[model samples]
Target: MEVIQVKNLSKNYGALQAVDRVSFAVPEGSVFGMLGPNGAGKTTTIECIIGLQKRSGGEVTVLGLDPAISRKELYGSIGVQLQETVYQDKAKVFELCQLFSSMYPDPLDYKLLLERFGLEAKTRTYLRNLSGGERQKVAIVLALIANPRLVVLDELTTGLDPQSRREMWAYIKELQAEGRTIFMTTHYMEEAAHLCDQVCIIDEGRIVALDTVDGVIENAGMDTMISFETQDEIGMVLEKLPGVNRVEQEHEQVRLYSQKEDVLTDLILLLREHAVEYRKINISRPGLEDAFLQLTGKEWKEKVS
Candidate 1:
């Protein structure tokens, strides 16, 4: 079943179009990733779908109801955690949890939530005294307390440590197991690749690519990367080589980008014929970041940084 659907969704700020004719569908009980660099219209599209921001054009439906018209009914079935969340600085950890729980029809157990989030020791700690990561944890706990059927998590693991991030990912997987659908926006390509059943790659408010993890890789024409150590700077005209698109130099290492699997083999044969001395030769398939860069023509560094 389709839990969320957006058709020709567009948002404009005067002359600048933030999201232009964006369209996608998120299935029920699946993790749908909305991925892009900074100013990609990802957040704008999300706001439109969630009915937090009015859409200038197009259609949006969440759980078979128009978000703009049926927002009140939809709120009960959806949990939302924005990128930036703040609470009363003087409130204690337990107090904040209890406060948010009261807003829900039947929230998760307060003690269980505290234990699940490793905040038991900090139960008495004031919100202002908590670290950035801990604050994020509290925010997430509040968002999920309702056990809503759908969850929209923007930058879900932004301030988490590696261990905490992994744990949160596990928790999200468990939520899906219990038949909850997740719509998430993230700058981390690896996170999307690992957790999302489908992803939509947005750039400048438009979907440049949308598909499964493997499908995006294939569609972006990112197949192989060849690397090896060389003694002399072998000025091989790699740009003219078949299936090779670009060549880059890092220190004394050469990395070649190509969609052809045979490019590495061909390079080895060429090196052997030319007596090019080298060591530590290797070939690797492209990762999610590689595919993302190829498709959107935007650097991940530009987003996360």
Candidate 2:
């Protein structure tokens, strides 16, 4: 079953169209990801789906009901963690958790959530006193407090440290194991590649590609990259080899891109034929980031750290 369906969705701000006829579906019990560069309408599209922003045109349904009309009911079944969250500075951690729990008919154990997020000791601490990472974890705990069947996370690990980021990833996997649907927007391509079952790449308010991680990479026509440091100036010679698409040489370093699986063997034979000595050789396959760059012609600016 599809937990979320969006068809020809569009959102405009005066003369500018932020989301242009975007269509996609999030399957139940699967992790769906929306990816794009900054200001490419990722956030706008998400806001429209969750009823936080009104769309200019198109249809949106969340868990079988129209989000714009059934927002109150939808909120009970869906938990959302937006990219940015603000709270009363004077409020304590436990106080905010209790407040959010009151709004749901069946809330999870907030204390257990705090402990899992490593914030149990900070329950009595004021929100203003917590670190940025701690505050972000609090937002996540509140989003899950409703025991929602569908969870929407925008930039889930933006403010987290490396360890906390891994922990959150594990928790997301746990959610999926329990048969929950997850829809998320993220600038981290590796995160999408690792966690998402399906990904939609949007550029200039339009979807450029939508597929599984490997499918996107394959469809982008991206090839395996082989690079090495070679003292021999064998320029343009590797390009003549079968399966080699492109060859680049820079000072004593060479990079080759190939589409065929036998390219490595052919490359070795060619190198031996020319007696070209190479070192520090490395081979890497195209990933989500490579596909995004190929389709959008733009760099992913967000650093995972």
Candidate 3:
């Protein structure tokens, strides 16, 4: 069942086009990822859905109800976590959860939510004194305490360390099992790849790619990077070999790229012929990070550089 459907969604600010005719449907009880770079208009598209921002054109429906026309009804069924959260630092963690829960007609148990989120220990901690990760957990707890039928999370794990982030992902999986539909946005490709059942890749307010994580990889068909130890100046040898598109001698490692899995097979045979003593071989497939670059025409490496 489709819980959310957007068509020809367009949003603009003065002369700048924020979202341009983007269309996609999110099925019920699925983890949907809205992915893009910082200026990719993801937030604008999401805001349009939640009726936080009015669109210049297009239509948005959540649970078959139009956002603009049914704003109040929609809020009762949807939970939202914004990219940045503002709260009184003096408010105790448990107190905040109770306050948010009271606002909803049917809310989850505050105590259970706190324990599940590993926040019971900090129940008395003031919001202002919490670490970035801890404060994020508090925000998540308030969002979910509503027990909303649909949850909209933006950069859910932005400030979290790897361990806490993983724990939170696990919680989301649990929520899915309870049949809640989720629509979230994040720049963390790996997190989206692992958690999202379907992904909408947007850029400059337009939809670029929309599909399952595996489907996107299959579409790109980029070869993975494989590294191996080889002697015999494998540089020139592997360069002329089939299935090995590029070869370089970096210290003592030979790097290879191939869309075909047999690239390593041919490399091994050549190594045997040269009687080279190999240490180890490593192979990795192209991930969501690679797909993002290919679709956006942006070098992801440069971003980190």
Off by over 4 Å in 2: 231-237, 249-251, 270-276, 303-305
Ranking by lDDT: 2, 3, 1
Instruction: Write candidate 3's Cα lDDT for 95-214 as tens digits.
Output: 888888888888999999889888899999888888877888788788888789899998888767888888778888988899999999987888898799999888888888899998
Provide backbone clash counts, one per model: 0, 0, 1
Clashing pairs in 3: 89-128
Ranking by TM-score: 2, 3, 1
Candidate 1 global TM-score: 0.83
Instruction: Flag regions of model 1 displaced more than 4 Å.
Output: 228-279, 302-305
- Which portions of model 3 show Cα errors greater than 4 Å? 233-253, 269-277, 301-305
Looking at model 1, residue 50 earns an lDDT score of 86
lDDT of each model, Cα atoms only?
0.84, 0.90, 0.85
**TM-score of each predicted structure versus truth:** 0.83, 0.91, 0.88
Model 2: colliding residue pairs: none
